[model samples]
Target chain A: MSIFKETRITRLLIISAIILIPIALSGCVSGGSMTATSWPGVTADESNLYIAFNQSVFAINQDNGKVLWRFPVEPEKNQTFFAPPVLTEEGELIVGSYNNNVYKLSASDGHVIWNFTGAKDRIIGGSVITDQIVLSPSTDNHLYALDLASGNLIWSFEANEALWAAPMVDQERVFLSSLDHFIYALDLATGKELWRQDLENAMVDTPVLAGDLLLVGTFGNELISLNANTGDLEWRFKTEGWVWSSPAVYDNNAYFGDMAGNFYIIDVASGQQIERAQMGSPIATTPAIGDNEIFIVTEQGDLYARGLDTAHPLWQIAIEGRMLSDAVLANETLFVASLDADNLVSAMNIESGNLRWQFAPEK
Target chain B: MWDTLILDPMINALLVIYDLLGNNFGLAIIVFTVIIRLITLPLSLQQQKSSMKMQDLQKTKRWKDLEKKYKDNKKKLQEEQLKIYQEIGFNPMSGCLPTLIQFPIIIGLYQAIIRTLAVTPIQLLDLSGHIYQSGFFSIPSSLLPLTSNFLWMNLGQPERFWVTLPIVGLFGIPVLTILVVISTYYQSKLTMATTPGDGEGQGAQMTKMMSLYMPLMLGYFAYTFASGLALYFVASNLLGIAQYSLIKSSKGSNIDLAPVKKSVKK
Candidate 1:
């Protein structure tokens, strides 16, 4: 008769709490757990496509979308590769892993030649491999320059925060953007700091060199042109939303898209908006500039081939998955990497937008 | 609907606090929890009052007589209970109303913390959409890549305190996990409902199981997931204890789940 003795209500409450507590806890952990192993990072050469995905890097036959060889052959729970693999001039593949090691593997057969385990944190961005040196950026806030042939650490320069962008290396100096609101210029040989400019916000993509001005897009909703030599802010152009896509600079124009679904063409010299068009979807990947056409993929999986001179779409196709990485162009075909798709990478004919091949490694 | 009304505002508010607190995420979480607790104070008080009233009514002589009179008839017992409730102008469901209202807040806070830290590319990209980017409510984009390093813990990763002990070399200890387990057990112990009989019914068994299982479940989470959430558990537990203490003090009685003697025998 005691109202407090209601077992049904008590049972229901306990059951609800039991069910909901895990859902709530899992709800918090699931976001990071699911994404900590991020999307596929794809890179290509003349005959092969290299994809660094969840647990292994696969070298695929470019023409047929066949996975030629996958490193390790068996996936490891602890090791993951998401940074776009860097192929050296010497036919060696340089790829960094979530296990905080960079491996130099034979590009032909996928055998480890040398492994560099000096870095304390995950290798998040792609490495820039030259003839003698490999420039790797890590979430540990260090841009490491390693010997190309040996994988030995030559020098390292620590930055203020995580370096999530690949260092743009030239003949003498290296330009690196960081999540710490600074762009750094370092000596190519010694990894010594040359100059750094505080842009007051994080930059997420590789800085594109447009003439003498370094065109860097930011989460701050501005595309800044920094002096390539002294790291001075030359000019900044504001946008409606964040510019996570790296600018494709051609003919003195910087072409990029914002999260607001607005694709913009800016005059690189003066930081002026030449044209802006609503793409109807958020663009997070860099646009692949072709001979007369530009291919841009959006976060919503829409691909548009537009004229270089106009924002009007020449042809648009809706792909089945979210496009996140840069669209890679090779051999008259455009390769797009997507997430939550049946295939990890899809190849399309550049002109007709016909699907050439879609690749997912065999089980 | 969920994102716009609950998650977006919670995330933006947490971010604003992080920005204002000089980029210390741990401090931001504490402050955010305090603010939320203060906002829900009235509702919590009302819930407590309703629970106390129900408990007080069950111990009354009239209620005991009704229980003895209707012992043989289950339907009659329910009818008599309803009549008593009507006469007293009390709603038995009122105690659960505040909890129902506050459920979304708990969910939103957990989500907001995870989204704000953003350890990966996809997480950061997802966070971008929920951010307030314009006008007076805008949080600066510079605040991001919010320094996940709070003290010795990376708020984005599972926390471990490294201790170099003699003869043991280096050991990574789950300090936060232990604290979470202790705090969760204490909170559950404080809030558990009392059984009317000799603690042998299904309800009492469930309450016993919960008192033992909640700490273990949360401890597993703390050990496996990011330390930021574990920190939240600890803070929320301590705050809940304080809130309970304040209510108990003002009302001059403990919210004890101590057994009330059975008037009817099965």
Candidate 2:
């Protein structure tokens, strides 16, 4: 009787452990605690839209919402993508993955051209394509510049923390914003640090080169203007909340929103707010500028179109999931992606708030 | 309510410790665990005393007689056991109350570690809202992206020690997982050894099963989650053993055992 009881207890304990271990460790799985850290990134050309979401990079038809092709054919368990893919003049798609690899694919059909696995950590920001070099920033605290044709390392510059903001390139230099609370300018040819300025807070958006002034938004709740050439602080426009997205520049003015849902129009030259409007939700993506209107998406999945002159919203439409990526405008159509697994991408008529087509992929 | 009361305070405290410890996250976790253990010492001692009293009760003749009498009638045995417990001024819940109170703290510590190592954008965004922005308790935004590197381990990822051997080639060993398993086993063993008898009772069987299963469960957790959490498990287990030993050595010290009387019979 005693032996039977002991055996039964041991068997019960084993059974309980078998049932409980998976349930207990489920939270530790990748993307388990949160669905995703960032939203789906959409980049467009004249023909197709390339979306870098979790587990795959998708190519959608521009005219009709159709899946053209998805990279890797089968989703790899270890690879996750969120950085928007950049297109080259040579019709090549250059993108980075959370697996710490930079892939160059043929734009016509998704075929691997070259793969560069040099970075040591996840790549959170999209690559900036220049004439000669492709600048990719990673969470490993390094901005890597690869040869556009062969995907070979040209040069890399190390930052103090993760580089979540894409590099902004101009004629002779590239400007980088790092979570290390500093903005760095490096020479385009050699990756040598030209100048750097500590903004006293972390920056997560690309530094906009608006003529001679570089405009940067920071977690310090300020829109700062710096001399593009000297890295000197020009002026600071304080906001009600942290400015998380890059400013949209059009017609000599800067348009942006803060995490507190306040949208502002600032005069580019004077760095003074021309007007401010409340969106009622946090905005974390750059606004797309059209002919006479501005398009923005809030974290609460609201899409709004506002006239540039009055800065008042003209129309608004509700999306399904959180809209955290920039709204892209091309060919009288506006494209937006969400964190929803079902309703991944939606294309809308730019003139009206009417939905043109919504693309929901099969599970 | 949980965030406001436990998570937010713990996260901020860890950050404050990290700042004071010169940005070393490993050192901060260690110090924070020690501080938490110190803060809950009173409850731990209360629990220890209750366990000791229960063990003493189990060794008494009245308890053995009640078990033998109730071998046929389980319900009457339970009723008589309750009566005897009341007569002796002992509450069985006293031994479990401290452990129940600690569940939220353990969860809070786990969440605080994950939040402080905010490696993802959404997690980082969530962390930003929880941080003290402006006040006497404000942490600098310069510390936004904290350095998770600690002694060849990225505290944000699972820990492994990579080694290149001649015949086996390159291998990654889970060093912290091993430590967590060993420390947990030792602590559980020490806890079980303090119990009165090793007979074939249901309670003894359950205790034995727990001793065998607890370490494996914790080892699985240590191997799967971020290394920072694994570090917490090791530190917590080792400290628990030390605490048990210290309390055991001071068994002769004066303690208020009002709930436990000498007689176990009505």
Candidate 3:
């Protein structure tokens, strides 16, 4: 009987160990990296970094790369970062999350200034903050403009399909794209549709403003430049794979990569491809531009810092996991958040590409 | 609830595998299922041992004595059984341990699937942004734009008769369903047959009834759920049969039915 008891206890212990070891290992792994897949828009307000991830807004120190404070949002399940938080002229952080709600958080202590609930779909596109209004496109297929101070809904522009791409606020119009294959230019104050241009396929990337042209990428692998005023097609460049990454306009060139690992540097004037750089893995995050250096992180977690003009690698840092979020540049420091690596967020020196500080939230 | 428990995970797991395997959802699911089974093996073995011991105890004379002692008294019977179980260091709750363990896994697996095979814009964006595209089989382009072309199902949505018929008929009959029912029946029979002691006959009788009842219950479930889940059930049952046969053969148990004998009068 004792022998049987011993064996059963041993079996229980073994089973427990088997189950617990993985959980422990997973905890350790998760703790080592800030590798959250949800792209919480990373915005810096001089001294602090505001990141929206998994129903929480984390305020981190710009210098040491430490989390100062975290404010939790309610409705936990499926509550994720949809659009990157926008820093408003009023100094409040405005962001929309997957819970079908938009929150205005205090930049200093990470407190909710106010929150407004929209339709049921998640808000994946980052909020576009203007001087007086904040606009966010949602999976509910509506472009919502809320009062920057009170969190009151001003107006909403409905689309045919869900809007995953963040709306870009220009001088008079808010340019936004949708999975419905249309780029809409709406009046920023009134939420009236100014003009709409139908792309060949769904637009999943946020439109970037380059001079008078609004540059956008689509699910159909087309990079289109439209006249920001009339929504007229300026130029379009075709690629072999889907374009999910938001295009970054630097100098006279628009740089973007595709799902097939091909990076294109297109001239903003004509939409003609000037240079194409192929990386080892697919490029999913937007490239970070600093001075003459352009840093691009791949889905495989390889960070390549190259000369903006030459496309020659200045330095390369290989994170252990895939890079999900775009790298942020603040005060000569490059902050990268990955979902695959043990460290969730890491600070690298802009010049030397040396590791400065790292934080893994789950660990 | 359905989206969280079923649709989302199924899609997510498929997308992860697709991203990893470049769109081969079938291979991804198989590999994922294998990993899950491997993880759950210890719990499964523990449950199996507990079941075997319970069967063994039921056949012992001690059990019969207690039953006879409490034949006319229900409360006393309960107390007596508890006392016997305490003495023997047996827990009836052991039978539920495996089920308890499986519940969370089922939820997790469902989540993985939904996250992987996300077809809609919202689903895809949510999925693509979250999961690591690292999987064994590349998601096939043929399924892209994401089609429900596996047998008779559009894997993106719930399984309907309109979708399942062609897939079912493609096998020249509903052979998969038949195999599913047969394998389930035999697994119950094998467990019943292997139960030690005199109660084996009674256990076998119970097993026979269960075998008939379970298939019907499962058929109803199959009709209602997405064909992906039905496919999963069939795969799991087949795998169970193989595992059972392997264990039985290794244990040198010939699970063939024995002839019932008349009770000898002293």
Docking class of 3: incorrect
lDDT (10s digit) by residue, model 3, range B139-207: 322233333346555444345443335545532244445555677677767755554334444434444
Ten consecutive residues with minimal summed lDDT in candidate 2 chain B? B253-262
Misplaced by over 4 Å in model 3 are A1-37, A73-78, B1-266
**Candidate with better TM-score, 1 vs 2:** 1
DockQ, per model, reads 0.50, 0.28, 0.06
Provide the lDDT at B69 for model 3.
62
By DockQ, the candidates rank as: 1, 2, 3
Better of 2 and 3 by DockQ: 2
TM-score of 3: 0.61
What candidate 1 gets wrong by more than 4 Å, as runs, is A1-7, A30-37, A310-312, A361-363, B61-72, B193-198, B252-266
State which candidate has the highest DockQ: 1
What is the TM-score of candidate 2? 0.90
Model 2 alpha-carbon drift over 4 Å, by segment:
A1-35, B169-171, B194-206, B252-266
What does the lDDT come to for candidate 1? 0.83
Candidate 2, A13-86: lDDT as tens digits: 44655565445345423344234667788999998999988888899998898999998788887788889999
Work out the iRMS of candidate 1: 2.9
TM-score against truth, every candidate: 0.93, 0.90, 0.61
